[model samples]
Target: MSVSTDLTPPAVILDKPQMAENIGAVARVMANFGLTDLRLVSPRDGWPQERAWATASGADWVLEGVRVFDSVGEAIADLKTVFATTARPRETRQPVRTPRESSRILYDDTASGLKTGLLFGGERAGLETTDIALCAGIVTIPIDPKHHSLNLAQAVAINAYEWRTLILDAPPPRFRDSDPPASNDLLIGMYEHLEEELENGGFFYPPEKKRSMSQNLRVMLGRAAFSEQEVATMRGAIHALARGRGRVLAKLAAERAKASSSSEPPRGE
Candidate 1:
């Protein structure tokens, strides 16, 4: 049977994932819990591999719809609420909740028409401090301190199972028809505009430094899928800033040209 959209789907994001087998295991877990959406952040091994498919078993559809991204921000762009799954605590002091508690909140939020997501880190190392900072909350599975770290797939499975258990007993939440978030074209255009403005502002000058500057900006913007309103708001701010600088530069140039002309004698005289 095909995956049903009647229940609210939890978007599962894998950040810097290590192997295809783990990805497949994640797919299987998601399928077991009736969650379908999967987002990948910078997978070390590319998707749709034989190992992943073999591990996925009956959940090939999840693999088919899995979206691959280059960064965590890109993976959760469209989601309004996001939970980062991590065992280790970070310096930022964000709200940390157990998997069951996080699942209940997610169930409630999604029932109220919020788009939600869960983020999982790589196998060896969990989510970086910066990545955890991006989430609204952190979901940690309770475990013995000596063996706190769980496998990547196991972590996802635990969260999914909790969420599923919450949702299965209740009447499925009404499927809200959310407007398509910012289209790829809009996002690409915004990126181009920002890069150009940064170049004009001398933020990314010196050809040697341009690569890092561009990359940093890309990572900052790629995290969430922006809405149309969000894109417009960002574009407006960029334009306002750029216009202010443009006007200042134009005045300076005009003043320089006028001074040069006044310094010259009349050509016909």
Candidate 2:
């Protein structure tokens, strides 16, 4: 087993795709899961499609090197093994395998330096019985019984993600790009500052339930696992809110004093 993320990706063949947009979407998803090889068999809209490139967004490389073929058999001639994607079972006898199972076999083949391919049918109609004949096995994705058909891109994504997971090792994920998680002490300090302002503002008005309210607040904040920067930002926002409220209180007090003085002025007159 290699610790490297890089591995050989299997060839993805789109058979008689009806729409150029769907082909572009398929390319996008394939790029997302690190699969590169893309083959098109008799696209109805023809090749070098402007819509495909536009829909691909920034995945121009996938479309740039795409191989167009006249038929499915011609495309898989170089591949040692080919798996056809199909939703419905045909009357003819062909071994059907799940996405994971098919991907496992693909991984094994690539490990031993064998080229493999995944065949996907058009958007309107899935892989035909005639097309499945060229494949070593059928890959069926288990979906809702009532509506089993999947989008062309979604089918590619499911299989590509599986194949990559089995063949490549992802580095243990971490928030390396952002600040580390805030310590318990820092989070507690933020909570205390916020609660103090809330109390001063009479947010915890019910004296009997103040303890329960604080407990709930603490529980909610504790589960957030805040980052260092996040805690500081929360504290800053609390301070600003308290300052604004203080200004309001001062304004009200001044208004009340002026009103009282005006009322008493009649005695001096």
Candidate 3:
């Protein structure tokens, strides 16, 4: 099957959220994963809470476009399929799906023009039993039984990441905007320069082992796969070191000449 490019994102419905910070965090996570539609069903404080904006951390777009409704039914009235997220299971007969499974279903449904929504409960208590009954399915996060409680934003992030995978088949590989590798000519030149320096510095001890030592050095330098700029920088470093050695030798030679003259007898004598 072909990948769907223009799939509609599901609406994020928060049912009776308790704190403004939690709402802000939820919006931030939703923005991170590309879910834009945010709906609130009777937030404890009120809609347009000033604290939410501060906690959102620049995810103003989600907060700006958020919709407020008096009840869950009204909030999700336009949606065709809805899934409720909860850590615990209910006694109802609705099918329970993990975040991953639910995301896959949401992807396919949205691709086929179905308006979908994900319902989340407040921070203190999760989705109400009555609210869970209204959804088409229940989305349960698989957390450790010893510490099953999850933050409101953390729960949203888990589901959002799964939703992101549907758009991108998998996480992309590491990318860098690096220049292309240095050409063979530049690499060869760099290797020769370093080898010449090492030779002058008496780095390769034992004349019999010079060839092997030189080959090992070449291999090590080649492993870096330097760029053009890197090659130039390395050559500059080698030249500077060579100049420093030359200056030291010249100074010693000048000092020896002065010592020899001081010990010579005067011409008049």
Candidate 4:
């Protein structure tokens, strides 16, 4: 589905977080994944804690605009759909999904003009049954059953990363930006120049192998997909080598003539 320009991702609700450090960590994680809205419900240490900013690293904006609430109901009052993040829910029959699946549903819901949110319990007691009942669904992380519990910040990070992947439209890796590939005419001209020099240098040894060798050379060079500038660069190198060969031949001719004159010496004698 296409992302809408006005789409706002699900807000994150932290219920009764025990540590100021965890709050800062959550803020940092939220910034990493582009989640702008953060709500704190019944934070144990209270709001406006200076220690949080130390742990938030450089994510000051999230902390600067954080919303505080006295209860879970108030925290998500404006949200249309909410998902509770829990390992397991007791007596709750709501639909449950993994992090990735939950992200997809949230993305679609937000695009359709619905306000959404993800509810996370505190570090100590976790979400109460009443709070979970308010959410439409449950998001359970697929961790090893032996250790299903997650750190408060770790849980937020996992969900945030999954959601970010849906919204980010990243391009494939490249070494450097380059112009379009050279035209067929430019390619052919480069090939002919290189082949002419090779032919003069007796590169296509066996007379019968010339055709097959030329075809192989063309195939190999074509695989580079050279840009116009690259083709020009290759042609310049070929021209320089050809001129050097001409100079070498001239030097050899002069040496031969001097030797011949010496052998015909004693003309005066």
Candidate 5:
């Protein structure tokens, strides 16, 4: 019934996990190493289940507070550094490290108050190439190459144990250093403002093409969660262009009015 104090509690992310029992077992493993903060990204089995809680047993706290997200990006939205746990290499070319090495790094960064997370793919197919690429690093447990497959909860337990071994002797946890980017309201406002300006500038015009154009623009901007300062600067640029276009239109309208009046044959003769 002992827990490791050296391991930093990670925000454990499970991507499309299949079984509720496996999820509960993972929670138990996390509890064994003093790790909590479970996050589920599109779990195949609906969460907050009695089956999972029953499996978790003494680790009910972890299972009770498990967070659910729609996507991997949303799951780790607040994390500064994330390590992906996978058995196979994928599209991501990030340096692969063993569980022990990853644990040491996680301990160091967590001690310095950096929000870090670890991602575990699903049971059957594992993580997709795109899912792997979303993480900053990859952690693979060293096992026999002849038969290297591991159960979902087993993988979680192994990593959690390694993390605990690394940080057990460190000092108390420190304050987190950085904060997440702007809130959703701020980002949505920026998107709307930019969309309006683009419409005014004839960038997203032709009426028929507006839908696709706006969607593409949203997708591009949405990917790079801009900082507060970046959002402010972008908003300023859009406003400047909009104001400039407004002035030019006003000037053109005045010129047209004056020309039409002057050419009216001296007030209808």
Candidate 6:
């Protein structure tokens, strides 16, 4: 059986969203969490923003399928269940639940063959009281009390991450690592070669900090966890720099010897 048959993502509704960039970011976060549906109600700058498409990066698919509405009522008109996301307490007596709880409810509703939607408010102002009343419940994220403000796209990302992780079983992140990390011996050789060049260039000034600087350099390189190919590249770069420095130093020594010979008086007479 196909996984799509068993799972249905909730409709993500943005009500009176102000900025086109924020809308684009919401689309990006939605794609990150395997969400696709995007609904807009009365955007300030109008629909089909060139800015939004540019900011979406490669998530043009979400923006392409966007459904525009005149109001929240019209946005989720056909949906039987909906949740409004807000930061503060609403005047309406709607049940307020955490993102996880709201996502769980949505999962249950969608699993049982019911249409569902998630409501988001404008960037400056959250969901209006009337909008909250339309939703069956409110999803509130518990953030630090000192600084509770969350940007429009950030709010979408948080709620979307919760729903995707708790309900949809999001997949692992993709990565590529063909070769193992470089050996310690290779790292030390690279460090020594680079440090010697840096010493010639007087990078470690004041003399007292050279030891600590060396240790810090090693620490920094150690954290890179460089692959064999990356290490090889770095080593090659360092060798080129060192070779250039050697040539310069040799030229300077030759010039100094010529000056000394010219200044010395003839002594064989």
TM-score of each: 0.68, 0.60, 0.61, 0.61, 0.65, 0.60
Q: List the residue pairs that clash in candidate 1.
A: 73-223, 74-222, 74-223, 77-224, 77-225, 78-225
TM-score of 2: 0.60
Model 3 C-alpha lDDT per residue in residues 1-269, reported as the tens digit of each score: 33345877889999899999999999999999999999999999988999998989999999999999998767876676678898765555567899999988787667656678899998887777656655666899999999987899999999999998878873322243555455445666676788788889998899788766665565456556566799999999999999999999999999999999999998894
Off by over 4 Å in 4: 1-5, 169-269
lDDT of 2 by residue, 104-148 (tens): 777765655556889998888777665565466689998889987
**Residue 209 of model 4: what lDDT?**
83
Alpha-carbon runs more than 4 Å astray in model 1: 1-5, 88-95, 128-135, 169-231, 263-269
- Root-mean-square deviation of every model: 5.7, 23.0, 24.9, 26.0, 6.4, 22.2
Q: Give the TM-score of candidate 3.
A: 0.61
lDDT of 5 by residue, 132-162 (tens): 6556668999999998878999999999888
Model 6 clash pairs are none
Let me know the TM-score candidate 6 reaches against the reference structure: 0.60
Candidate No. with top TM-score: 1
Q: Report the CA-based lDDT of candidate 1 relative to the real structure.
A: 0.79
Model 5 lDDT-worst window of ten: 176-185
**Candidates sorted by lDDT, descending order?**
4, 3, 1, 2, 6, 5
Top lDDT model: 4
Encode model 6's per-residue lDDT on 85-199: one tens digit a residue.
9986545555789988888777766665566789999988777765665566778899999998888888888888877775545332224334444544455567778888899
